[model samples]
Target: MTFTYQMTVEDAVSFQKELIHHTEEHERRRKVWMKYMRAILIGIGYVGTLFFPYRPESTALHILTAVTVGFLFALLLTPLLNDLYAPYMLRLNRRFLQKSQTWPKETTLQFYETHVEVHSVSTNIHRTTQVPWASIKKVNEDETYRFLYYEEDEALIIPKARQGISEAEQLEIDQTLEKYLSTSPNV
Candidate 1:
């Protein structure tokens, strides 16, 4: 499940907005729950101390305990919170990029996109590789996999389950993206 398309900041922002608007209820619920959990943890740290003060070995120990507990909890929760709010963060980033008039910076995704070919080996090996479309000699997609080629050489192989878009709709979407890439303004 892979797509190759080029887009600018405006397109990215518009796409993000549409995605947010169309996201499933379960995802929204999970995001809300993650926020609640983070708030609860922070509240517990402060509120619990009020109800049951920590009797430190000394003043230094008291300060250390407070800092340690607070920092530890914050460190642990930050990633969790980020994971939960990733979609929202992506939208925010897209919006920021659009506002800043930086198309390239905005359109440059963290993930790589290139023509790829998928292959399977009986040996103990599994990896995804990027192959430029110009170098691609072939391309194939099935219900379960997508294979790309590079001038008689095969490139990346990806499982359908991992594609971000629906399998049923991927082929159509990919074709549309391929068309868009040719005309879309590069960031």
Candidate 2:
């Protein structure tokens, strides 16, 4: 079977966001620590607000307040900033790291018995990659896309809205992926 779709910077950023969400869900200890840290920062902020006009004798409190506020600002703002900056960062990474300036290009995937071939083409670049079925570490899907993850942080994004991907085709792809991935020890 074959499927083709547009791959854009927006798709890359969305994948990054999805990866972050997935990581957060799986990292329970990290989430717990972040929650505790947020609580500590908020408590410090409250204490600092209560003693805003610190006397000369309260030099330590003034310093603590300054430190706590800085941490609080970073803790609260980092995710927001990341969301805002991710698109630009992905674009830059594509241009410099991947050395591809043209994106939002057509990507085609062809599934064979033993491997999947991916072809991506733009004005200045044309590339094809063949991934053996055994090399796929995982197959995951959300509402809008199917992710064929070959590594922890990398995947082949197959958008469900692509023209050739009908419901039956999706089911076939899912079955094919399941058949291959279920046999792989890494998954």
Return the top candidate by lDDT.
2
Using all chains and alpha carbons, the TM-scores for the candidates as numbered come to 0.29, 0.61
- Candidate 1: segments with Cα more than 4 A from true spot: 1-11, 14-57, 97-187
The best candidate in terms of TM-score: 2
lDDT of 2 by residue, 118-177 (tens): 999988789898888788877666677777777777777777665656888878877777
Give the lowest summed-lDDT range of ten residues in model 2: 81-90
Off by over 4 Å in 2: 23-100, 183-187
Report clash pairs, candidate 2: none
lDDT of each: 0.48, 0.68
Worst 10 residues of 1 by lDDT: 103-112
For model 1, residues 1-187, the per-residue Cα lDDT tens digits are 4343333454444444333433465367657767677767766664455444547667677656665665567668778676656566566667687676434321111122554333322224443444555564444544544444343333233334432445565556456436423433111
TM accuracy, model 1: 0.29
